[model samples]
Structures are given as C-alpha cells and as structure tokens.
Target: MVLNVDNYHLKSLDNLDVKCDITKVRTEVIFRQSNEKIGHGIIIQSKHFDRVAVFAPFSGIIINRIYSVYVERIPRDQQWNEQESGTYWFVPSNQIPELVPISKYSANDRELIGPLVGVVVSKAIRFAFVWSPSLGEGICENHENLVIGGWIKFMAE
Candidate 1:
C-alpha cells in the first residue's frame, strides 16, 4: 500500500493546529539542497515514501518522534490534550529532492521538484520507531528525548 500522507490534518482543542500538505498538494520534500550555511536540515531520501507526516516543531522539553524518522529537542515535557487532527509532511513523487548528510539535526531544508516521496506500506511486518493504528485512523507514534529548535527525521518503513 502507498502511504498517502497529504490527506492528513492535525487539530486539537488545546493549542495544536496543523495541516497535512503532502497527501494532496504533491509537496517537494527537500533537505539541504543547497545553502550549506544552514545546518541541521540535511534531509535525504525523499523517494522512499509516497506520503510524509509532518508535525509542529513546537517548543518543549520532551521532543517526540517516530524513531530515526524525526528528532526534536525540547526543553520540557507536558501532557498535551492530544491532537484532534494530524497533518501530512511529504513531497510529490516527481518532486522528491535530494538530501545531503551533514551530521544529523543541523542542516538546510528547502523545496525541490522530483518524484513523489514514496513509502512502502505493509500489513505483514512492523518496524521500529514506527507504528500504525489498528484502524489506521489516529497516530500513536512519537519520538522521545529532544531539545528545542531541533530537527526531526522520519524514514520509510
């Protein structure tokens, strides 16, 4: 199955309000395409997933992610009321750009044109740092240990 992530949206009764821009818009998943000046955005592997999940890089202490996929460094950990809606983070299969590996959480990111970011979806095996709901409705995934203004990486499983 293909992970079409643009159709996703995230909205909360609290302070979380995000929208998925990869499932439909055919986004351009980019990383450090150029401008080596900015670090912590070295995004690579765009063609690996059809849809990408993007969450708010909100400020906090408990940075959560889906394992090797995304990383964030927060300052504190507070119990959120739970997001009402979840958004998508992805690029078009033709817009999937290149990602340069420069450290990890310090690189440049931008938009480019390429193929749709494709991710393999399987109902057989599960992956580490990744989870899919039994109903495939809500997301029950997050990365632990992170700081503020940090970077996150979510790979295709």
Candidate 2:
C-alpha cells in the first residue's frame, strides 16, 4: 500500500495537451525504488472493500503505451474540487471513472507486478490502472474512443 508518485510535472487541461516526461515511466513500481519513483504494489476494489490504488503517470499518450494516468485513491480522506495539493491534474479520458480488476500482486513470488485496474469513484473517489502488462490495451490516442489525458484523485478532507 505505497504508491507515492509526485514528481510534479505539468500541462494538461483540455486541448489534450501532449507534452511528455512522466518521469520516464518504467514500472515494477518504479524499478524496485530507491529514493523517488514511488509505487510499491497495486490493488483495487471498493464495494467488496480492498483498497490500495495508484497509477499516476501522465504525458498525454506516451507512444500508445497509453500514458496519461492519474488514478489515485489511497489512505486519503478528502479533497475533490479544484484539487491541487501536490498537483497533477490532467483530465479527459471521459473524466475517467470506470475500471475493474480485483487482485494480483507480486514482489518476487514470481515476477508479477502488473494487472491492477480499478474503480469506485464514490466513497471518496477511487480510480486505478497499473500498466506494463505488455501494453495490450494499455492505451492509444483518442478522438471517439476517449483516451485523451486523465487525472482524478483528490483527497484532503
């Protein structure tokens, strides 16, 4: 339950801003981490009550690996309206709020730190998406399919 991504980069709000430099995304929860590049494992589920979510990658569309992610709903309490605490507010994936994958974790039980999707945008907001599962439907550009920059975890109450 540790996904502390906040290297604070910017630019994302409506023109589907495509800048780039999401701190060089390379997951494994940020390559076994040492200092920054936060992210430990992933988990998601709400009504059934399993929570631990984090996937804060954003850069418009990192080459179809579907970059723009900002799904956050952790041990936070409240903050969701003009939210800008540590900053990271890209938005457009249809205002992202619909994901579901229940379980899957690994640190070395067999080299598996992928699959961990999520959703539960209510009990204080919860949204998720952990990638690098070989980028199957990771993401691509958008027009009608909707993937066009996203960010939506706000907590501070």
Find the candidate with the highest TM-score and give its number: 1
Per-residue CA lDDT of candidate 2, range 1-157, in tens?
2222222222245412333413221122221122222233223222211222334332332221212223322323334321222222122223333222223433232323333331111221232232212221122121221222332222211
Q: Which ten residues in a row have the lowest lDDT in candidate 1?
A: 66-75
Candidate 1, residues 1-157: lDDT per residue as tens digits?
A: 2232332232122311113311132122333224122122222322223233333222221221111222111111423221221212322222222333345434332222233222112122222121222112222133232111111232222
Off by over 4 Å in 2: 1-111, 115-141, 149-157
Q: Count clashing residue pairs per candidate.
A: 55, 4
Backbone collision tally, model 2: 4
TM-score of 2: 0.17
TM-scores for the candidates: 0.18, 0.17
Q: What lDDT would each prediction earn against the true structure?
A: 0.24, 0.25
